[model samples]
Target: MTPSKRLLSLDAFRGLTVAAMILVNNPGSWARIYPPLKHAEWHGCTPTDLVFPFFLFIVGVAIVYALETKKIDISNHNQLLIKAAKRGAILFGLGLFLALFPKFNFETVRIMGVLQRIGIVYFICAAIFIKTTPRTQFICMTGILILYWILMTLVPVPGFGAPNLEKETNLAAWVDRLVLTENHTWKSAKTWDPEGVLSTLPAVATGLFGMLIGSILKGKEKPAAEKTTWLFSFGIIAWILGMFWGLFFPINKSLWTSSYVLYCGGLASMMLALFYWIIDVQGHNRWCRIFVAYGVNAITVFFLSAIISKVMGMIKVNANGEEVSSRTWLYDTFFTSWLPSDIASLAWALAFVLFFLLLLWPMYKKNLIIKV
Candidate 1:
């Protein structure tokens, strides 16, 4: 693929994920979202569950493309190790900074997050890939996915004994208690974290899968058309297999089950092939420009929005001398108030996405990509 071709497809994929993220993350009323937009309760998949994993997958693809056979010479392996260590630390440090923002508390803080998972996986997987073959990398990915599944499903929890999907008894919660000091798990699950250790194992697989794509893209002599066809064909096969496995393992984001990994990986690949076809192959550039803009500086926009939304929620209106959060009032007045129902609020959230995309368009055009 040409540089433009690469940029277009990644931009579109990243843009779509980032936009959906904003929508799901900022709904006016969580109660009102369409079923597809909401996450599965315990052990299932939803359209919403695909976004974070999709981002992780993309990160893996990028790492392979950027780090493979580069002049970053592995002649002095120690130097390469140092570089990997620094990158991992920096990524984790950034995640900590975001977790500490607005308030820094040792207690009741989130220790594991999306960025943290990415950081750890990048370091571990990159270290292995840097010293190993593509075949070994594939084997490692498969082993880790299956290993995590066995550990979570078969290994008995201390005291609690065997693992169950129940919030209180799951391996996730058990490990969080052992590893995360109390109150440091995601606030949504005071005793558990979706970004916990066992889950991260499969997430590494997610990234490894992307590395496979990146390697294929970096192939020396295959025709682009043949590559595209195989990608699409492979996606179909994986989707079918994943669904069948889901019947036994059950696709769940919180657990980051192997089946979930297969399902999301397939979905991500299909979306990529679609975007590559429509944007790169078909030369349809109009709508892609908007997505590319948001996708380019995705992390910045996400963190910025998180902080801004919190700040806005803190703004209070002294209505009749009674304090109330103005954020809700503003969103309702601007988006939810006039709308007939929940769909209107959803539309308003989407408009909010495009508005930010327009804001970010110039930065993307100028080749300004932000990374943590």
Candidate 2:
């Protein structure tokens, strides 16, 4: 595939992932969310569980494509690494700002989060892609998966003195408490965090998996059709291994276990393969432009939509002589009144997606790419 075609497929895939994220995250009522949209209770895979990993995988793919030029010119290696670190720092800072918004509470602010993890993985993966050969990268990826499995399953928790995977008592959770502190961790589960420090090890593995595929995609030695077949085959093999590994490791998104990484990374690979086949290989592009629009300014919309939702929750208004959040008032008045409970929730979420689409359409038209 030519460079432009490869990018088109990637952008569309990323847009689809980000759009799914918005849908799952902003249902009108959390109480009314559909089963597929809700995250698994503890130790299973769900469609909703794939979104974050897919984003990270895309980040890995992006790093390979974005830094390939510098990879060739040895003189530019340090300059490229510096640029990657700066971008990573900005992404991490944005996540921190989001966590501290409207409260500015340093005392109890959640430090590790979705964007923060993305930033960290992106930084590490970018450096690896620039400095290492494909063989070395593959070995590193294998080592990370094996090492994380050992740490999580064999090593006993310090105070508990038992290898555990329980939500609060697990080794990852224990480290979160020791380092991030219980007070500064996730509020819902103060003793643990879904995006905690130790879990990030396997999260980086997830990105490496993508980086490997990206290296494959970037290779000129293979034809596009051959590359697609190999990627699809790899996806199937990795997915089956993940399911088998789940018996021992138990696929858990919160911990970002190795099994979870392989499972979701396989799914992401197949999805990207399909997009690449249809959009780039077949030269069919018009149908996927809406997703392209979402892709172009994905972080912008994701961040703005989150901030708007929170602000709406904070702003209260009088409705029927009772005070309620503006979000509640809008949902109750327009969505709940006409649609069934779950359907209304789904519809409200779709509206949020469309709202951003409309908001971003002009930007897409003007070719305003907001680089973050």
Candidate 3:
């Protein structure tokens, strides 16, 4: 693939993930959501839980594509690192701004979030990619995963005594509560943030997994068939290993467990392989333009959609002689009134996805790809 051109599959895959992310996040009524849309309460994998890590994996792939190792030399190293840092900072800042928005509550604002974790993982992975060989990158990725396993399993929580992977008493949750404090943690669970301090270690590993695959995909001499084969093989191996490992660690997305990394990363790898085979290797391009639009301006749509959702909730409109949130009013009037409860909820979420895609279409047509 040329530096100027992108693999259609990657964009389609990313756009699909982003679209799913929006759908899961914005159901008209949370109570009526499909089982697949809701995250597993604890210690299990759900389709909803896969979106974030998949995006991180895609990020890793994008890094390899963007900063082709063959092109960068030692002299350009500092500049590349700086650019990576700047991008990471912008993403981090956007997350922070979201947390502090509307209320501007510095005291009780959730400090760690999805985008913040993404930024941290991207920065660290990008730096590692630039400085290290594939061998070193592999070692680093494995080391982080093993180290996280050891920390979460062997290291005792401070006051709790033995190591545990419970919702609040686990080592990672303990660290989040201790450092980020109850006030600044996830609002839904004040005692522990899902995207907390120690959990992020393994999240970095997820990105590295992507970077490794990205490197493989970027290999110039390798045949497409060979690359696709290797990806499928490794993906299956990782998926099996993760399942076996889950007996001990449990596949917990909230914790970003090592096993979770392998499991989700494996699925991501296989999905990418399928996409690459169908889109790039097969030269099928006619049907991927919608996803390409979403892919090019992913962060832009994600951030804006989130902001818009919040704003909609804040704006009240009179409905049945009582003031209700605009979101609520719209949902009740059009969605629930026309469709079944669950279907209406899903329709509302799908509408949000379409709304954002509409916003992105013109930009994609103009090639106004916003990179952050």
Per-candidate TM equals 0.92, 0.97, 0.97
Q: List the residue pairs that clash in candidate 1.
A: 157-161
C-alpha root-mean-square deviation, each candidate: 2.6, 1.8, 1.5
Error of 1 at 30 (Å): 2.7
The order by descending TM-score is: 3, 2, 1
* Winner on lDDT (1 vs 2): 2
Task: Please report how far candidate 1 places residue 311 from its true position, in Å.
Answer: 1.4
Which window of ten consecutive residues has the lowest lDDT sum in model 3?
A: 1-10
lDDT of 1 by residue, 1-372 (tens): 012225578767877787888878877667687556788888878789999889887777666665676524768556766777787888787777778876787676688887788788878877776787779888988898789878877888887876766776887678887888557888877778888876888998988887787677667687768777767776787778779988877888988889888889888888887887778778887888878887777777776766767787778887556677887667666876678558766765676666676669889879887765
lDDT of 3 by residue, 1-372 (tens): 112358788888888888888889899899999667899899999999999999999998888888875436888888988988988888989999999889998989998998898899989998999898888999999999999999999998899999999998999999998899999999999999999998999999999999999999989889999999999998999999999999999999999999999999999999999999999999887788898888877888889989999999999999889999999999999999989999999899999899987779999889888778
What's the TM for model 3? 0.97
Candidate achieving higher TM-score, 1 or 3: 3
Query: Who is ahead in lDDT, 2 or 3?
Result: 3
Consecutive 10-residue window with the lowest summed lDDT within model 2: 1-10
Query: Model 2: per-residue lDDT, tens digit, 34-61?
Result: 6678998999989999999999999888
Q: Residue 118 in model 1: shift from native, Å?
A: 2.3
Candidate 3, after superposition: displacement of residue 364 in Å? 1.3
Which consecutive 10 residues in model 1 have the weakest lDDT in total? 1-10
